[model samples]
Target: MKTIKIIFVITFALAGLTLSCESISNPDPINAIDSTQTATIQGTAYANMDETNDTTFSTKENYERAPQGTNVKVVLNSRDFASNIEPGVDYKSLTYETTVNSSGDYSIEVPALGDPIDAEIYFDSFKTSQTQVDSTEEQRNYSPQQFPYTVRISAGLSTFNDAIYNSN
Candidate 1:
């Protein structure tokens, strides 16, 4: 019986030691494709050419003067310029991140790897609700019209300088 008790104590001690020695990892690393090169596109918002409204002004004025206003967004997808891009060959993956700048310029970042990055940008417009206006009185004055915008970026070369060099 004493021998059995000794063995039991030894087993319990070994189990405790093993449990205490276990290692744990904290702060998991973010897993995302590194975009070594970045491409940036900038533009100003304006009323659509077909629209008869002359409420074209800075987002500040538009938001303050009209009941409806528009917001800009940058969009990126797995597409190739001129030709269809194969999912795995021309483009590996896709991720969408959006940012609203204090200067009213909407920015988005996407991951793409290929010769030309094919993408589009859409402008979203909406009419402010009465409740919204009461809450954000300053931004509720714009007209109620929205237009869509599209942007296409060349791949590999991320900057205007690179584009110029390639053309030459």
Candidate 2:
């Protein structure tokens, strides 16, 4: 049995590209069709690490950029042609990793879904804070967001715009 769900996509790919179409019954056109050109994906991540002025939510001003060296995980699976896929590559393979710049932002790219008929994306926004001031004691209090990060890939879709973060 397939349970229906509605997802409001607040992000769009560059150049106003709509790789898939939407319908009243199904919010995602990618799942309905088998072959297409590409897919759109994006989102924001928030974590409480170094909040200046002890603010509750993370903000760019308060938090230092994501230390440019940090890398985020992105996985994709175009479940179509067996030959196209490597000997053992599928979704959750961690085949792709991208770095987050000082702005705590990342652009995720995966094989387009339409090549076969379907593509799924999983982005991991998990990172630990580093100690500042060479502290012997803990740098700061920690409280992580339980829910997965919100996505902002499609121009037509948006949710939780961007994450708030504070610098240590």
Candidate 3:
């Protein structure tokens, strides 16, 4: 009976690892067979885009007047978030970070990587929230929740980022 129990546990553990390893699937290529690619990423960052009847100015106007307002910083990673490639020395620093325009429109051109690879942009709201105490391994002392804007952008066949962000 003990032998059977041990065998079952080992089988289950192997199965779990197998499933986890296959969790990340390679997505379709962003561009065709091009030696290089240049694309523009344009989108809006706001608590909400759904315009209510209370606003007098145009939809563009309201977004500019938002208390959260502008200066929202977002980072663009060279590789997909799920890729096994290590960040190495220059990771986040090498990433392309940009600020949204006053009207909430963020337009930036993706640098030429000289190869076909997945590009991803991570936005964490406008401001950075701090933690109460520093205790983590990196000593970040910051709450991931503070960065409420969790949007993953996968480029399409076209050059435009295609208005992916649509939430508070």
Candidate order (TM-score): 2, 1, 3
For residues 1-168, write the lDDT of model 2, one tens digit per residue.
Answer: 122222222343422345444333632233332233434444454444543343444354445544454555544333443334345544233245666566666665544432323323333344465444443334443222332233323222222234343323
Worst 10 residues of 1 by lDDT: 159-168
Candidate 2: C-alpha lDDT: 0.41
RMSD of 3: 16.5
- Candidate topping lDDT: 3
Cα TM-score per model: 0.37, 0.40, 0.35
Clashes of each: 9, 21, 1
For model 1, how does the per-residue alpha-carbon lDDT over 1-168 read when each residue is reduced to its tens digit?
999999999999999999999997674343444466456655443322222232655343333222122443445653432244334454432445443344444444455455556555554443333333224322222322322334456534432200000000
Which ten residues in a row are the worst by lDDT in model 2? 1-10
- The C-alpha stretches of model 3 lying farther than 4 A from their native spots are 1-37, 49-93, 113-115, 127-158, 162-168
Please give the lDDT score for candidate 3: 0.43
